[model samples]
Target: MQHNLGVIGLGHWFGWLEKGVGEKGSLKLVKAVGTKPFEDKAKLLTGFGITKDRYYISDPDGKIPEEFFEGLDLVHISDPNKFHKAQAIESLEYGKRVIVEKTLAINEREFEEMKSFLKKKGMEDRIYLHLHYLHKQPTLALAREMPGLVAKYGKITSIEANFFEPVNEEDPRRTWLLAPENGGIFMDWVHTSEIIFRMTKCSFGGIKKASDFGVNTDYDSVNPTGVETVVEVSGSSYENGALATMRMAKGTEKALANKTLRIVFKSGFSVFACFPGHEAEFNNAGARGTLKILDAKGKEISSESLSGQNSSEIFISEILDFCDGKRVGLNLDEITEIFKSQWEYQRTAGTRRLITDRESIDAFLRNGASYTYCK
Candidate 1:
């Protein structure tokens, strides 16, 4: 497998990509790209000993950026929305593969353009890294296992989901997510709906009706259906001690959201998913999986799984798949399904505005919302 990689941005996300390479078991960061000044770039790579030779040539002219794709088989696009269009097409044009980060494009149009370009370039084989959820082993496992469970437990009855973020005023990306154009909460957090849609194996969990909760009013089209689920979201982060909640559902106490990840099952079971550190608030430091069930006396039965794998090292598993030229176990089709479901939900959802104050929020939770998307 090729160890070479080109980074299009040096912001927070690229740091995540690099941090994972060593643990990825089969990947090496041979090359990387960033627009930081020479001294700054040197400082950033000082520990890695990455030299000028490995530094990607800036696409000042957008002409393949000499040696940009030199030894690498994949280009990790971490650039802002405006650049994904050109960066993705150009990376494919150079015959290098692409591993685009979340919310791959600014909108449907840009995403479509990249898809069309891939078809034009005949580089579909080179595409990798869809939404993060599709890579979740348990979710995929559950999605696969749900049919049997439903066959035994019966069809899902009702679902209430929350997938919103509380953005910090000092942060750029969080603020960016507040806006509608760049996907904001609706687009970023829409994955919650997608995952439920996928797992239940119903198209939008029968999505019948919905109500708004905060400034997050992206939902407006949901209506009563036998198989649908309705959801709401609210958020803010105008101050520090800031936090966010990625997901919460019915019967769960409303807590100040801080990268919280939990799911409740009708099997009288509950699962909490802990992702690796991306921030002080969001980082669980390592992977920890917990299972909870109500005992006969109403006591809770619980178990947990800790990963020996590092967050970044996980990507190498997929790289090995590419090396073997087989699709293997990656969650490509699952994410595709989630994306489709999300498109439908967004087209037909509603929203509400919640009154927020620092005191009120801290009395429970600071503002925290996750941008995690569905397949």
Candidate 2:
């Protein structure tokens, strides 16, 4: 059975979310809930989309009445951080699976409370997270192939990486990047999923760890000040003003290309085999073997290339997977746990309330405590 979805927050990225997700490809919109009442509801979302059945809520505290979520299967929440935990908890209680926006909550304290609420209601399993595109996160994509990639060459001795991109000057200017209660950069980046890749997925050997100061959002503001944060995870550091470095062999395709990358882990030696001046498009995503110890000296290691389905599609394919019998590996409990640990790390390092704070979500988390992967 296709899941009937109710897209609550219809904002700029609403279109992107509709296009890039679940059963929406075939199911009905079921309902659309926005912050405004039916009148302004349609107005705020003008020009984008507003189906007939989709209604609006004028007062910020309005609800769909009793049993409003009776038949809905899923609810995607893209509201501001301040309203997320509350709205999401309600949706889950009403029996709607949830995919909340980043940070999950304004503070770490709420992160715990919301999920705990669901666990107590026997709805924790139904509560899910749907986050937007995570920037600069190709790190784990590389790690997935580590086992096979390393087998042919040699054990990975050392790895290095540097990830940095200027804030979308235009996008943030129009969104939440400006508010502190909305959880400035630290809340969005450090306390959320972006850092999950660093915590559990990537494998690197770096000695120093550091975090950079957060830059003022009103960069164009006259006496601007920014938050400076330093955190060490997975052997790497974060520096705001300086270039990041990961000391692994530049021997792979996804590793740093522009900066210095030298990988010398038993595979003779490989230096960004896909560097622009070298191989082009096909060579772009797949790993390249610079020097493998497989054949005799002077023998160039063969370049491997392949592509097909993405994991998101695979993850989604498992949706009705639970309909009949449970399938293995279709779920991401371990992956989610790895991600939760990073959230805990962020809560400890920065001043914020975590998901563990909410009494309800705290119970929600306990249920998962034993569902870890067997591998």
The candidate that wins on TM-score is 1
Give per-residue CA lDDT, model 1, range 40-152, as digits (tens): 77877755556776776455533446666777776777665456667777877777767776655555656667667666866667766545454444345446655564454
User: What lDDT tens digits, residue by residue, belong to model 2 across residues 1-375?
Assistant: 566667666665455454435333544455676665566556544433555455545245534444346577767677666677777777766756666665457665676676466557766455555442222123233344445555655543433332222333343444554355555444434322332343234322222432323222233232112222222333222112222222111111221123212233445533221111112212344322221222324344543332333323333444334222244231234334434533443445444322222353323222212211110
Q: Name the runs in model 1 displaced over 4 angstroms.
A: 24-26, 56-66, 136-152, 160-170, 173-178, 190-202, 205-255, 258-286, 295-299, 305-310, 328-336, 341-375
Q: Single out the weakest 10-residue window by summed lDDT for candidate 2.
A: 247-256
Model 2 error, position 119 (Å) = 3.5
The best candidate by lDDT is 1
How good is model 2 by TM-score?
0.57
Question: Distance (Å) between predicted and true CA of 66, model 1?
Answer: 4.2
Global local distance difference test of model 2: 0.41
